[model samples]
Target: MDSRIKMENSMNMIFFGPVSSFMRIDAESLLHILTFTKKHLIPISRTILIWDLITDGKTAAFLYSREYLALGPLLNFVPEEDLYYVNFGDKSVLSFFANHNLGLHSRKYGILAASYRRYYGDMWYEDSDYINELGYLICGFPAHIISKITPAVFKKIDVEIFKKLSLCSVNQTKTLYNLATHKNAYGKPYKWSSHEITKLDILFICVPKESISSIRLEAIPAISKHIMEMIHQDKLEYFTKQQILRMNPEARRMYIIRVQLRTSLDTSQIAKQDANAIKKSVPLALIYVFTLILK
Candidate 1:
């Protein structure tokens, strides 16, 4: 059979077949298997395949044991909020903690819910669940990781605001972050959420500004921190102020590529005449790695 036809058949199986067939497969092996089989699947297909595995209990458990979900394997593909809810489900406290100990890093909601239950014994699970879902809306901390939060704290949370932030409707996070960090009319700190910065820390690192326009300006600090460090350390080529502004998106992409590859492939080394060829070739290579893996 033609290679293209064979690839199509493999994809059909992944999309149409039951996920249980892939349950025992761990994350690393699954990634290799998919990439090896077709080697050219599209991003959408890759996203779907990953979604299938993570949402399925048995398959997610297998992969979670290997601690691969937060490893950039599905970076930018899965929505950060949904991943937490899907993975947490309604499992017992012990099961939740067992999965948490696997070194899975992201998913603030899951971590918050588990921590809350660990200390409080589900006395206010509904409150925790609500706050967990609400945390997905704001850019910073989900709910403060407080040892003792008053009942008023739950009442003070605005469900409408949570919906706006969660849905990402019209500059919600940008506005919220600004207000949360600013002081009130009395010049005292305006407490927005909880005290922990873990969720916000992860959000600052993982969110892609180029892809999501609402937080482009807000994410500048996050994006610039890494890129500036790279240039200062001589990992990337230096650029003028105007050049850096224009190259923000490309710079961010390069940052992710660098983190993923962990190698120094300086663009400055590629000759000007061959630069265009390399620029086009990079996407083709990524499409293969991302989309066309085997079952």
Candidate 2:
């Protein structure tokens, strides 16, 4: 480590840039700087994207993780590919990534890659975005991993992603249901709302019997047209037949009736189109048959 770099008074203003330039002149100096760098002195808000410069991302990440991790989300500086070199086996490292406000555009890219790379346990997430990312995954993520994801993600999650993920265990789904309808932003318990229950999309399939019993039967239709539009898409994301059977009787009945009505409308339109095609085909068929007989 060089004595010239020891000036700590200007770390926030002059640290990373001069250090970067000096590192280029003598690459070994960068490692020394990273080794001796004070964890608290690094400025988190500045827009410098120095993370890509480290050829040895793993060693560099291990040494300077405290200072540079927020750079990943803040600058989108560390791509998921770069993070592959850095080990996140430490729970604090992984948790730090979640607790930070996300700057990564997609939930699947860096966040998903981090969780997917690890085995389940010590798993939990503070950012609601992680839940949004996990919901859309094409492959299996451990159901238990959902134990800690912010339930707020469910309210804003793309209904399509919500539909694709019906992988919760009964207890996990119940937990999501509990937190979503009966909890506040701080994860404190709140009174559950039957109307709020309708907003959970595919999670509606696994509603606990107690919740179903609580839903106001007459009010089910009043859950709002916009909300229904989100839930009752033409494409099925979750298997509704058996999966939905366990839903509260009132909610289940409403879901079935809506689905049946949608199917009936679709079938009737197709039937009319087929009837018109049959009328046009009859004349062609007769002429073809007559030609065949004459031949």
Candidate 3:
């Protein structure tokens, strides 16, 4: 906040040595500089320096893939009238975006995360690599099939399914799930085919039922994968926590449906006397319909 400190931060460029010297410096002044810094005057290295210096991730995320980074955050330096240009497609920039937490409020976060998955096939979850994959699968696949997949299940899924799930559209994933679901309906394990089985199919056969559903739908897979890990460890009670309960409403609804299905199924395994409890837990009308169909 001091004048000299602000000028010192502004003149950071003049201290031409290893970045280590300034890396620990507070970046508030540098963030101030970002306000008046012209498109051409923007120094890539200094920006990276600010990214490293700033402990709070939101501010750090604004430095690279500049345009996409600017959309969500309110920065004093970046004038809305001025068009900031940066190539988001570059591999290095993509990697940078992939690593940082850009605060979930950004609308473009889902698309950028998908692009990151496309360029690098790192699996965010054991079964699916990107959140978008889970979203598409939830919108397209049958919930019954999704519930059956456990880590111990020895189903061989295609290697390319991960990439396809992350990149494919809703209709594409839906069509693929339909193919696999139709085959599975015939009372046998559907043979997995890389050509015939799509990423959505693999996701249905892998992601936890509790994790499907999203307002955007493309981002559910990421949330699912995160929740899937907790589920695997028998941490079913984790969802009762406030943070988990406060997730996107659509996702919460989908998860609640999953829990209801599980509860209904479990009740069916008990004696006739327990049937009354199931009716109290799930809406009777919905339970009756699922019973007639799912049974």
TM per prediction = 0.26, 0.31, 0.27
Candidate 3 error regions (>4 Å): 1-84, 99-101, 104-189, 193-202, 205-295
Best-to-worst order by TM-score is 2, 3, 1
Please list the C-alpha lDDT of all candidates, in the order they appear.
Answer: 0.39, 0.44, 0.40
Reference-based TM-score, model 1: 0.26
Better of 2 and 3 by lDDT: 2
RMSD of 1: 15.8
What's every prediction's RMSD, in angstroms?
15.8, 16.8, 16.0
Off by over 4 Å in 1: 1-28, 31-42, 50-85, 89-137, 140-170, 177-295
Question: Mind giving the per-residue lDDT tens digits that candidate 1 earns over 158-231?
Answer: 43333323323224343333333334311112121222121233222222333222332323433444433333
Q: Write the per-residue lDDT of candidate 2 for residues 100-198, one digit (tens) a residue.
A: 433344433334445445633344355444444444331234445545555564455544444544433456555555555534432221233444444
lDDT for model 3: 0.40
Compose the digit string of candidate 3's lDDT tens values, residues 126-165: 3533332333222223334334443322134433344434
Q: List the residue pairs that clash in candidate 3.
A: 35-77, 131-222, 132-218, 134-221
RMSD of 3: 16.0
